[model samples]
Target: MEKTYTVSVFTENSIGMMNRVTIVFTRRHLNIDSITASESEVPGVFRYTIVLRTTRQQVDKVVGQLEKVIDVIKAFVHEENDIVHQEVALYKIRTETLTNGDVEKVIREHHARVLTVDPQFMVIEKTGHVEETQLLFEKLRPYGVLEFARSGRVAVTKPMKELSTYLEEI
Candidate 1:
């Protein structure tokens, strides 16, 4: 069965490491749904949060391969329930929509915030699970969304232990 799995890869920041990590998926004929990379809690270490829809066996193999990468300090595969995750989505709605009270109502209902209000467009930002963002997008579509972008999943295990602890242990 195909189910979403979040792969959290911790590594030292280096050039061409992403290419190598992504290539492993390509070689295995897997599709990467989303990928987000940013500095982690530990200084100098970076985290790559990659989302993929595949079976447990495949995800296990992929994580194993990722851990073998020279720069990869650790790699973990987590099911949706195992981690606390969120994605940020930004919607650029037509400024004219702001004239009517409907847009504001929708934003309040969804708990979304207006990041910027420009004459040409008003940017609304929502940070939540995938479904939450999709629901907001659906509601805002009628108002005219000039642009919509959602970032890849960023996740951390639910356990209280920080990744830095694991890094120190190893």
Candidate 2:
């Protein structure tokens, strides 16, 4: 099974870190689905939320390689027990395929918001479980989806816990 794994990497914020990280996957021929990196709560540190298709063994190998890179303070694969994860998806739908009633029905059923109504498309913003996000995509298929963008899964361990916290105790 092509399972999805979310890796949280804490590294120094500097040049070539992304390149180095990406090269690991490229060299292995593992095409990443999505990646989002940004400053973390800790200064001089960066956090990357990478979504990729692989098995548990492959994920472990990837994390091992990531930890060896310079400036990588820590790297870990987050399972459901280790973190709370969520993804956000924005879908643009064509107006032609949807009547007002139909749109309302989908919106109510999925808890989605119509962000804008330009003459060309209607933008919807939804945040929730990955399955829920996928459901929106399925529902909007008949409506001619114009474009879509999703933020990579962002995760932090449950209260009183964090990746670092878990590691420190080890």
Candidate 3:
């Protein structure tokens, strides 16, 4: 069965490393749902959080292939329960239709905020789980959305458990 897997990979910071990692998934015909790359807590290392849907076998194969890349230090696959994940989204909507109070309610309920406002449009920013972000999107759709963007899932395992340590033991 196919399931969503969030993979965290640590690699040397160098040119083409991201491309190499991305190409592995492309070659396998897997569509990455989302991806975020940033410096890790450790210096000289970069971390990538990638979300994709595939079978357990395919995920294992992909991670194995990723580990073989010269720049890749380690690649680990984490299911939903293994880590805490969050996604951020920015939405631009028509503010003329919704009252400030109504908008404030949505903002307070979802912990969103107005990032920008023009005479005609208001840009709202929100950070939350996938479903929570989607729910906000649905609520704002009625007011007409102008534009939006979402950061891919960023995940970290619970305290006392880290991907690098877990991989090193194996």
Which has the greatest lDDT? Answer: 1
What is the C-alpha local distance difference test score of candidate 1?
0.94
Residues 1-170 of candidate 1: C-alpha lDDT, one tens digit per residue: 99999999999999999998999899899999999999999999999999999999999999999889899999989998999999999999999988879999999999999999988999999999999999999999999999999999988889788887898899
Model 3 residue 100 distance off true place after TM-score fit, in angstroms: 5.4
Instruction: Specify the poorest-scoring 10-residue window by lDDT in model 3.
Output: 158-167
Sliding window of 10 residues with minimal summed lDDT for model 2: 161-170
Candidate 3 pairs with clashing backbones: none
lDDT of 3 at 111: 86
lDDT per residue (tens digit) for residues 11-72 in model 2 = 88888999988888888789988888988877687899888878888889999999889888
Q: List candidate 3 stretches off by more than 4 Å.
A: 98-100, 162-170
Candidate 1 lowest-lDDT run of ten? 159-168
Q: What is the lDDT of residue 9 in candidate 2?
A: 84
Give TM-scores for every candidate, taking all chains together and pairing residue i with residue i: 0.95, 0.82, 0.89
The predicted structure with the larger TM-score, 1 or 3, is 1
